[model samples]
Target: MIALLNNLKTYLPFSLLDNKAFKRIEESAQIAYYPENTVLIEENEIPSTFFLIIKGIVESKDGEELIDIYHNDDVFGGIELIKNQPSAYQYKVNEELICYEIPKEVFLELCQKNSEFKNYFFSSIVERMDMLKERKESAKMADMMLTRVDDSILHSACIVDHTMPIIDAITKMENESAVALLVKNESGYGIVTDADLREYILHHEEKNLTIISQIQTYPIISVTEGELLFNVLLLMTGRSIKHLPVLNAEEEVIGLLELIDLLSHFANQSHIIHVQIEKATDLQSVIDASKRIDTMIKTLHLKGVKSRYIARLVSEMHKKMYAKLFELIFPHEWHDRCTLILLGSEGRGEQILKTDQDNGLIFEEGFEPKDQVEITLKFTETLDAIGFPRCKGNVMVINPKWAKSTTKYKEDIRRWITSPGNDDLMDMAIFFDTFAVAGKISIFKDLRDFLMEQIKQHKAFLPHFARSIESFESPLGLFSRFVSSDKGHKDEIDIKKGALFALIHGVRALALEHGIHKTNTTERIKALNDIGYMSKEDAGDLLETLEVINTLRLHSQLEKLEKEKEIDNYICLSTLSKLERDTLKEALKTVEEFKKVVSYHFHLSMVG
Candidate 1:
């Protein structure tokens, strides 16, 4: 039994289980074996026993239709017993099967004592696999060597036609403070840097440097936009090339990325952006500071900074930017009359990369001034100019629908919860993530309290709210394989749809249920675990899975942007490394498990 416990400790649920809990399972277990092709359980039979396979393959059949094949370390019967349904498939030995069979009573006892173990078994058999490794690690290095090439402060290249003379290139570099110039050619762009010119000057006569094409380095070694700064650094160092042209997704030379600027950006990088944000007194200053955020994100993320941490930092920066812009646009007294609030992911503080504006204005009751419209419009437009794109849905303060008084917003919330339409229900969900970035923050708190009270009185709304988790099936089939779409994006998948949507919305619904104060998804999951809504092991897995999904999605989005392709939620899977692909598959599987738990919790199966 001790050896059995030790072996089981290597697998999940058991691996994460406490010693006392694991001992109970070992004590109640018994060894059992069957020969090859032996029928162990009949189809549609009411089973009261479970088995953990020790060796050989097992086949499950439904009316002579092969269901699936399970091998070593696979378990059976727990799902049926947990759901209290009759065995749906016949279990048979494909090879000689050696196993430990535990009675139904013990299985129920274990589930009662440990919810994590219960959750592990309660989801489908596909969720039963995968080893949980410790995943906490974040330490900033001596030099911030991590950043995307495009975000790495790329200097616009001095472009000239192929017919230009070498002197023209030199004059352009000196005039523009540029380190290199890209010469247009039929095949592609050719580049000549300051170093190339120096080498030419030392070796050749002045007449030899006549045409820029004469001194140009053809078939340039360039880095794509979203590629890591480290790769660029290594390339420059190894090739002894000081100037590397940066290419867009179309393979066109867009700019020159110099080693000096990259090194300077890394130097004292920790305080640079923050200092810039604090010093900005005007729109242009704010714009100069705001543009660095994407590079900072790419740098930190590639350097392994946690997503939640990055999101918080980003939120703080955005808040500062907003407050500054608002201050610049409106009278100081106006700040007292209204609060600038963020909705959706930004409100939750889980936003990574600059997404479209999901923000609004909550004003003091009856404080609607005639000039307030012009002021708020300026604020939203400035935000767009600062790189925060305008919301296509018109969820920004520029729209009258979002810019409203506190009393009016509360009235809207009450109506949504009381007799909500589809759009109203969505608005309710978005508002649930509302967070105040500027002005009277208490205005935001007051709204949250009102919304929570309405929910308490109308408790039935949660189930309907949670039904969206079923809106898109996770991009994984029951047999634990990737399932791409047959429609548009056939070769790829909407990763956000398949892997992230269910998890995000499900967690969001659960957070609202518990009235968890934190809106950040990672923080919400931790809050849930702390309050015993989920077990520690499950919470840990969920947090890691969320980070992994966010990271993977960011990586895909960056690639699409680099290629100048339409950047949506679609992920081109062909670009993923083997390790990334495997990790993604596992994450999607976890989403499937998450969906089932949420379905059962909200009685979503009975929602219709």
Candidate 2:
């Protein structure tokens, strides 16, 4: 019994239990063993005991269909025991099984005593699953948190008295091999960097006689010894400064922090890639710089950065690449006359990988260049070479239909609103997510204002737009199990159609109706909530659901790339952890609930 209690401490959530609660569990638990193929709990029978598997595997079956497999250290029958209801599935032993069985009454008593344990088992599955995943990610980030600024600082303080001459300070900085020097005066301390010295030398020829205090930057920016290394990096980036003084709690300067030191310690590949992109002068060099994005993304993911922030960073890099391409291909004069618009995911700032090129061109009326066709074709070819595939629907600027003047786009919007059909609605949806990546943004703004006015005037367009979400059903069954793909992949489901499209389209339709111009789904939900179109709680759930779905899709794509397979949105349930599976189910359920709300608001039933 003591050994069992000791083993229980190694498991999660239970490890959080107090000693008294653990003692209660140990005293009431019984050691049980079963032969292979033994039936532990049958469907339709109420569970009287909670089983914590110590060894072997258990298969959960709904009739003849396999629902899930439980391995060692997994808990079963908790939900059934909590609800005091019949088991939904039969728990059958797949191998010789050993378990610690706790009585239902004792488990209930433990729940009453330990709120954390109770919450883990009884809270909403989504919340519990999210907590578990966060705990796992927190464990992974623990080591990074231990890295302090003091650990990364390479040199001791290089200090100069306030009365010291500028020339002497420079000599001292060079002697110490320090990029910056701390200057102390009657008031306090300040920092003088290499850049500051260069500027001082450039402007003043009498550097030898000049006091260091006059040229040194005052009001020192410094980090404490115990501050996390990552936070220091963020501070430096935010301030656009490369050097900082490391101070003790008593305000005494102990060390100096140089950007090179932090960069070497963190080895931020993204920063290196950004520098390379900025310095690249040729198309091939830019393309080469773009290829390092995958590694950067993977590194960020491992560092436990949130998915939304990762997407934002990736989008920023992509925009930089596109802007560089434009600089190389288009003349400086032409840039002011044309608006380069990105449609769909790129415009929405949610693109994490190079998928498709959904872009167009908008020229000021009567300012269309005669060589537009040749230039756009070349631009599209360059983008394709950079790994962005051409849009299957020919949404690229290379298509003459998409390359139009602002006046023509306004007319197109009017036609789409007046004569709404499947293709027109699809085109309108795509255009609604437009963002100007380069060139004249005011031209795109004019078209956007005109679009909102037309959409508001034609009230019938809302129902037509909202009805499109009905094309795909939530891929969850009545019992909350996944509705597997019908395309012969039994274990896989289309996360894009089943969850992503539903949430995105539903929120987008609402945002358009309410005149909220935010293209990102999460931001759109917030805008909807602010306008009283959605409850705060519902909007939060929708945002979290979108995040989880996107995270799962990204992980699947990364896995595919790791295995040298083609990337797609299909996720295999067997490949995921049990916690992730539960979270996904809950996320899909939220999507379904959101769809119902959207349908009720738009009155989609009256459409067709």
Candidate 3:
């Protein structure tokens, strides 16, 4: 039984146990083995003892369908035991099963005596609770931001030749209410519009006699057939054009892209700003583009375009601008040789505003250069110019320490995790979440697999890493009030620090434990739920809480950008809508629940 307890300790928050505690656990545990397809535990039944699998498989079921099947070394049932509640899902053996059954009181005694073990156990429970709250919020938010370009009906316009008279084109524009005409030219297609006509009337002064072809805007802005009208709107707004010709590769006109055609697709400004970021060439251009981003966010805040959509739009723009900045510094030849990987918030497509840089580089194997060091420094400088503030801990690719070939990078990660320091381990946590944004995706995949392999080997890293999740406190303070301070900014709490970071960091830890790498908070929570890291109710709540945080941060960043302040993650709840404020309060409450769960899992002492 003592040997059995030691074996179970490997998966049972062992970090929290000492010699005596281990012995106590050993005495309390009941070792049992069963053949395949036997029901080990049933849903809603009171768990007599928390099951710690020794070998074989334990399948968690919902009705008759198998939801999860745990192999050797997986832990469950502790959640129900800790909560003193009924089992939420049925447990059965899908194969020959070996498990050590430990009673709740003995587990509780271990939790009480072992601080680290207690933290680990309670943290998991609290984290699960927080997930339930966030999931609900995220679902409501996703529904609000849904967009479709298929709402508008496409009307076939009268096709005309370039030789058509100005009066003839005017007649067509009036009859069809079409703002533009696509005419076949010797080269491709020419665009003639009311804007073109007006320009001719203003500039030419003798347009009554000039041929429409002479005044036509050549090389019309166009899109491929079947392109979403939403994308067309983005192009038009980015270029400040009113009309675009939809064309096939054969240079034939398919349809006309119009502002009116896409008016119903999205909130106009968000769509337009996305286009602006894509077209921006330099830092100043991005700054200008962000003004529109600011306005769009404000409109969403006012009109209530669910927070999830707002977060998604902000993340999309951030990625595009970063990519564009990279394009500006390193044109096609250089960019193709390496992949720019984004980790943390930006990688997950959940960034609401400017935050610390969480990025790295994955250069192609055997791309050693004569001036590699200088070139890397130059690349980093360019990103800084375009507003990706340097990572405080120097995680950027420019450091050369982080920039490595696929094989070397994997070797370094193994060294970093096995013999970790604060900085090295932090880097591992960040880099582990990385997803490739640009360049060879195959290289990205290889790097991801290598990192995952390391993580699996050193699963102990997760609980240690998860311990940091609770280091930062949630926004709610004494008496359920928000913690307020004037540090960095006056008369306001750093919402990002006090609220969102804790949730994000905690979720990220759980994600690592489960080997789920999807970045969007909602997506992460859902994935955790599917695998039983979080219950369904908890997943729903977490999604909502994330949406609220994202929505608040989005609006705040937009406001800051408007005032010419550099974008940062700070939100003043006073500036938010009543509904937003209510959601925020609820979200903060949910965050506290999340923190408690993290503390529980880590065996950290908690107040409530």
TM-score of each: 0.59, 0.69, 0.55
Residue pairs with backbone atoms closer than 3 Å in model 2 (clashes): none
In model 2, state the lDDT of residue 151: 31
Instruction: List candidate 3 stretches off by more than 4 Å.
Output: 1-266, 270-292, 322-328, 331-336, 370-390, 485-491, 573-585, 602-608
Judging by lDDT against the true structure, name the best candidate.
2
The 10 consecutive residues of candidate 1 with the worst lDDT sum are 129-138
* lDDT (10s digit) by residue, model 2, range 1-608: 69766876746667667888887887789989999999999999998899988888788999988887776677888878878899989999998999889999998888777778877876776666556555555555665556776532335578999999888988988886666789998877988886787778787775543888888889888888889888988899899978788888898888777776568456435665676577677887778778768766765665556678888889889888888888888778779998888899988888887778988989889885978889999899888887887898999999977898887888789888998779889989999999888898898988899999998799998998889888897789855667885676687999998889988998889889989988887788888889887788888888788888888888788778779787778998766655677788889988888889889989998987
Among these predicted structures, which one has the highest TM-score?
2
Can you tell me which runs of candidate 2 are displaced by over 4 Å?
Answer: 1-39, 42-74, 77-270
lDDT of 1: 0.76
Q: What CA root-mean-square deviation does each model show from the true structure?
A: 14.8, 8.9, 21.2
Candidate 1 wrongly placed segments (more than 4 Å): 1-264, 267-270
lDDT score for candidate 2 against the true structure: 0.81
lDDT of 1 by residue, 325-439 (tens): 7777777886888888889888888777776889898888978666867787888878878777778888888787888888889889888877778888788778888888888
